[model samples]
Target: MHLEETETMHRKITDGVYYVGVDDHHTALFENLWPLPFGVSYNSYLVVDDKIAVIDTVKNIFTQEWLDNIREIVDPEKIDYIVLNHMEPDHTGALPKIAELAKNATIVFTQKAAGMEESFYNVGLKTKVVEDLEELSLGKKTLKFVHVQFVHWPETMATYLAEDEVLFSCDAFGSFGALNGKHFDDEIDMRMIESESKRYLSTIITSYFKFVQRAIEKVKGLGVGIKFIAPSHGPIYRKDPTWVIDHFDKWSSPELDKHVTIIFGSMYGYNLRLAHTLKKELVELGVEVKIHNISYSTMDNVITDAVRAGVIVLGTPTYDAFPFPKIWAFVNEMEGKRFQKRPIALFGTHGWGGGGVRKLKKYLEENKFEILEPNVRCRATPTEEERQAIKTLAKNIAEIVK
Candidate 1:
């Protein structure tokens, strides 16, 4: 079996490395939770040398396409290695099929990932468990592995190709958009990638921010010259790989943008009015402001805005003597995602009682959020006094963000 004498859709990263990933414009939601407005790509790569290696695999649904992509470059049976950097289905979904075809291929991954193979696909294939900073020779090119656990998964790792200087960084520096016809950073609109990358980090990996920081540091410590960063998703960073690296570092860092995000859940128009008024006031004070009605907006965008803002203002009308369920769920997501501690302002309205603001403040405080003063509680509509209190809250927020 040798390289097929056929035309292929696969794109080249360098002389020997090729992009065999597939784009999914059909999956409306990623993980059945986060919205995929721009769709996404399940990236896979092939490095052809004396010993052929296939890094990562596409989603299960695209198994045939993926195999065809590989066959166009080289016979599947000729593949000497099938590397699984993470156990997630999106990356390993084609594993069962590929392992069956690549009879001579050895599946390589970390110890934890090896243990998960059976539970995931039950494919009784030959395996080679690698360790942290381990290196494997592929004739002229060398593959190096780095363990970056809890980078959204317990068994996640990254692979580096020495000769071509490419890093197969599973999901470390990934985004949400599909590559489409363009595969390199220089070939596409970076603005869309930037925004989508932020949303991706916030919704997909924000909970593992600490591990992300560590992973970035670990990759840096490798001291390898990475000309390209081929992840399991999104575009390959070849023109300016450091640009994505800096972005990952900045997003995971403690420093935040000097902006305000107002999230409100209202039963009637009262809380919405309050949220609008607050946004107007903040804008008037020359502070950047983003407002979202949690009931109308999706969680992906809401969480993305919430994570980037320096200050967060939550407004919710009382329901069943508690914060509105939507607002409560948003707050709970913040806690579950381990949102960085930041100053927060709480406000809401009630028909019979005023438990919304109090409950929200308590929960936020318990989560280490710095509760700003003037937890405004209104009844039905805002009177002149309540409006004045809202102004005060806006001023306080402006001072902090500005």
Candidate 2:
């Protein structure tokens, strides 16, 4: 690779179709993904044909590299259109700079996306707002837009190239890894990318799955042969677009495994021991069980499993007559997201007067979860008798599901 090509990995997907993938480091908002600890990538592409079109721009910090990438493909001034699949800064932060470079290029986006442009950059830029299923001609090539609202954002949409069978999926089917010399889905590490993709979808997009299901159906209805899926982040899906479609299909459905997720926060070992007992008894009843110590587990992963499991059991030791702070924070986050219609059971280790279980039960009921019978509470460290009582509670949970 030449110095210029190394700086910007630009490859032609087919005759007259090229994509420039840029790397970005976002340390603040996406802290959970970093340094190979958790990961994220900001991807942009440039298409060169009879008329040049730049798909999306990278972050402001990567503006120079992004612009240089576009320049390598074609003179920025010759670019005809800058497609805005999403208005998120990770994708649109360099829009103003790109607009300045691509002087006369028209900005194509949904109506809501056009409105978002003002918030991101100063006024006075030419923009063309297209509605759902609207098609625009770029010389011999044409791109169509499909409105996909609430699949993370109101202005989000998927751009389809009629001739190439490629879909520029914004954040809808993206993962959390940077592409290292590899651009196509089949060429890269499948297991790692698939796991990261699931983490991203489960944590960030799980709440709006119904809209995602509708969007999937919409894409399926188009009857277009999607040979490539170029998302705004992670490696582009070229070999298998159906892989992402399958993932979205499974996640968007309400289907869940016959497993129980028991999450708890305990200052001492009392609540922890109770959690183990509950898991053991549930396992004995032929139910798959997962136990997470809240103090150690990341909230994002915990919530991901919670959303996938059929039953959720929360155990928190009483602190100042209320649930532990970590548990409180977790529940607060779940409530803010409007989590609904799941079976939940609450238990706590308390001293003196035990009001934490009752308090938690009330809050759980308010959040639309069906509170199972008993809502088991143990006084301080559970004795053998208390352990036996927990076994009965686990049986009740199994019966409730059955």
Candidate 3:
């Protein structure tokens, strides 16, 4: 692995393709909402084929570094193509600079993504519009375009290298973590990959649940013979390309895990007790459980935990005749996820009347959840009867989740 003066590392992905991406540890947030505590990588690829095509561009903040990396493998001026699989800013930030260096390179992207790219940068680079299953030949390698719409963005697409059996997935199957000099999944420890991938999907791809499934099916149906997956983020899957796709298929499906996520908000600690009680019951019933206090935890983390659960438990304390403000906001955000039909249990404490539980129940029903029978609600503290009801609620949830 030879490095340039700027420490530019251009790794050979295959005989013809090279990894020319850079890690972004300075960006505090992804999309300005999801936290990037572990940092992320803005991946780009260099396809050294007949005409020297660059797969994608990096962020503008690393323009010089990116250009240096490109210069390491091939003359920037010799590059003839710049492919845009998605129109997202992170992937297109260096377009203007790159176009300047690779002066004669033609910008290539889907017909649908062309408008967005033009509107995004308005750089007058000669362009080539490709369609789904469209083939672009670069001497020895044949690049096939697979249109995967709404995998997160409206015009998002993926590029497949036919000869190499490598799928350069733009954002699909991407995780939010820097590569730390490693170029392939086979080279990195995968203990954290699953969680980070789940976090990325839950935060970025979950909203497009049906679209995700459709895109996966559309690509799989093509039978392009994928053996490597080079997503725009995270480690490239070389040993097993379908590895991330298989994970995406299961995540997007209707099937839920035999696990429960309990989210609770408490002002006087009574609501938290109910959450713990429910967790204990679920654990005793041989069900996996994770409890989180929404007040301190970010929504991204909570969403990741909730994505595959067989059951969801929402606990809150009544405040001003309604559910706690934070909990209500979190639950309201979750309301948009109407595709999930998992069993739900609402248990909370109200000081005077049962306003919190009533409002939460309405919200859950509005979101089209299959609410578990016998919800637990108590005034101030749990009475003997209320405790018995809580037990019943837990038992009913166990039956449905386990």
Candidate 4:
């Protein structure tokens, strides 16, 4: 019904701002690729200032629920501003409908949104373009729009509230899981959210890492203090905003985790043995290690570990003169993400020939990976020398992970 009447919805954030967002518990896939087993949340906010301002809109499918959230705070017709941080359908799919609800609401976004507004929304925009460091006052509260291009989209921006020290980040610190009841990061189980947050960053924000780095730097460069990060997705960061910011900076930067990831595919268990052996060796060397059997794990899961790991060891058997199909698929996906420069250790079992190993070497080399010394090719089984070779490879891999 309405926010004022309902007790379960519309959690308050600070005195003036309230969380007017909805959760999609049924959506199986996000962006039509990544699985959303925990579902996802499309976070919207309501600022009850001298003039009511609504920050971002939700998907068209959730229009009524969203409108109900808005109605709980202030009348939709009384809303004065609708701030759009990103033009993705998830955030703007209901723009036309919302525009109808708040006929006098002004659409505020970055200048880049000008060229693509009509093309994406197909509705005439009553718009005001914000500059690099633009500011607007809604009486006592102030809103600042900072452009963060390629944080998944070119027209992306983040809205900052100077009075409350809250940053309404578009999707910078967002995760994939729906907020079942937990709205803030401190309110939920941090351990459960950590993995989903990493998956979100690795899947959605991995491609634009350079911009992600630049965006964080640019926002911090502004010198405006950020106390709470109310992103348009997932939980808001109120307990410690720096925790998420630090997480973003660490993940977006080139400095990866000091860990080893072993992605392997085996035809007859020889390559499997090689993978486990390397895992044991790396663990003994005090380096964190994660292993994935490609046959059982998805490519997304493999990429999740490999991207953050400083060293990647691929173990697979030759099949039809190429690396195992699953392993090939995994590498191909990582290649699409432009993975490069990390130390790669390759070892596998080949039945009759060594063409698969050579091809893998060339592929990684082409991608400019730093090839470790002695990438051994086991002949269908682990020999005494092959076992020692793997041990040496493990030591080398641990050394480079810093």
| Residues 31-121, model 3: lDDT tens digits | 8989998899989999988878888788889888888888889989899999999888899999988887777889988887888977888
Worst 10 residues of 1 by lDDT: 1-10
**Candidate 3 — which residues are off by over 4 angstroms?**
2-7, 337-339
Runs in model 1 lying further than 4 Å from the true structure? 1-8
In order of appearance, the predictions have TM-scores of 0.96, 0.94, 0.95, 0.93
Q: Ranking under TM-score, best-scoring first? A: 1, 3, 2, 4
lDDT of 2 by residue, 183-227 (tens): 778778899887788777777776787888888899999998998
Alpha-carbon lDDT of model 4 = 0.85
| lDDT to native, each model | 0.90, 0.79, 0.85, 0.85
Residue 245 miss distance in model 3 (angstroms): 2.0
Which is the leading candidate under lDDT? 1
lDDT of 3: 0.85
Regarding TM-score, does 2 or 3 come out ahead? 3
Winner of 2 and 3 under lDDT: 3
For candidate 1, the lDDT comes to 0.90
Provide the lowest-lDDT 10-residue window in model 3: 1-10
